[model samples]
Target: MTRDISGQIAVVTGGAQGIGLAVLRKLVAAGARVASWDANAALNETVMAGEDALALPCDVSDFASVQAALDATVDRLGPPAILVNSAGIAGPNMPVADYPPEYWARIVAVNLTGTFHVNRAVVPGMHEAGYGRILNIASIAGKEGNPNACAYSASKAGVIGFTKSLGKELADMDIAVNCVTPAAARTPIFDQMSKAHIEYMLSKIPRQRFLEVEEAAEMILWTVSPANSFTTGAVFDLSGGRATY
Candidate 1:
């Protein structure tokens, strides 16, 4: 039960708000020195100002930005021993046929490719340190595709695949790479969704409610903790009984 990450350097993408911010708060409470990498630099700075954390302006979709953020984190808090890929966006909700091509590209770029960028940038340091825990934020939609959210669902599916592949590649080491498939949480991401889409999501959950950010954070913290020594290339579900698999 002692999932302490004390003294560990942690990096959380999209740590400015929502699930990412929740995870960052928990990491700090667990005694980890966390660097919050967010594209919303101003909001990140404002929110991280009072916490015992670092806010780094980073757009995870860009490898250059990811590298710079990693450099800054290493210089400030040493190589991150824990990484939580929480940076993501829920693109406009619409049927696949109606989904804008541009929106699809943007969604994948930020959600799927962005996860790759951050992981790629941080793993080397963890490898050198001989210790690391990576937790990627996937979605229940990835498992049971949401009806009008093709891009979001597809991108999250890619995250699950990416996590599994990376986890296997690093299984021989102390590093453990894993991801979580969470049901819809009522966060800022909701603003991008239509009212009917939100209702549809809520109805799909057996719990008949949305996921809580803190609940998501708790699972995320543990997944990236030292206690998660054996589990790798696995998907932890926070889907409220919505995911059959």
Candidate 2:
């Protein structure tokens, strides 16, 4: 049965812009009450004006922040049945030998640990409701390690592992935990990368073009929909024909 997510509450981290905002828009159009959880208050408010999306200030890297955000979201929008972990950072491009310790820590904090924090906060609600959908935004760099991106690759790899384990643990339940690995999209995230790095990513894509945020968001919506029943502990590929597997 196709799940019409009408009236279901959804929380999208990093919903201020990029793929997160795109997903937020789609979910709202699908009849879901959506919350835009992001650290960027100004941008979030700006984007959510007429969209009617609740804007919540959340720093996913911090467990306290995540818990508070989830609490606030539930109080305002009702318990979220859909959770999308799209908040992440692409550390500066550099060889592993020259990678900054601080960058490595921040990358892992926001990308890997952040995923853990949000899931921890929301899963209990889903468990109670006996239905839930989670989608983590991973990266193609994790599958085929990028040359100058060790922190990003490692952190994303951890996200993949975490999703797999969480999905398996929840397979017996109605909650579905899965992640998607997408090739580079022309989001503000690209501002963190170097020209060389961007060109390298483009050269690798058989499609020879960057991904669109709308394209990525559509698959994510479907992944979290009721139609996706029985597909858990899996990785969905959106790598522009780059992933060999």
TM-score of each: 0.97, 0.98
Candidate 2 Cα outliers beyond 4 Å, as residue runs? 49-52
- Model 1 local distance difference test score: 0.91
Candidate 2 backbone collisions, by pair: none
TM-score of model 2 (CA atoms): 0.98
- Candidate 2 lDDT by residue in tens digits, 1-245: 68699888899999999999999999988999998889998888776743445898899999999988888888777899999999999989999799999999999999999999999999999999999999999999988899999999999999999999999989999899999999999999999999999999999999999999999999999988998899998899999999957
In model 2, the Cα lDDT at residue 2 comes to: 89
Q: Which candidate is the best by TM-score?
A: 2
Q: List residue ranges in candidate 1 displaced over 4 A.
A: 50-52
lDDT of 1 at 38: 96
Candidate 1 lDDT tens digits, 102-165:
9999999999999999999988888888889999999998888898899999999999999999
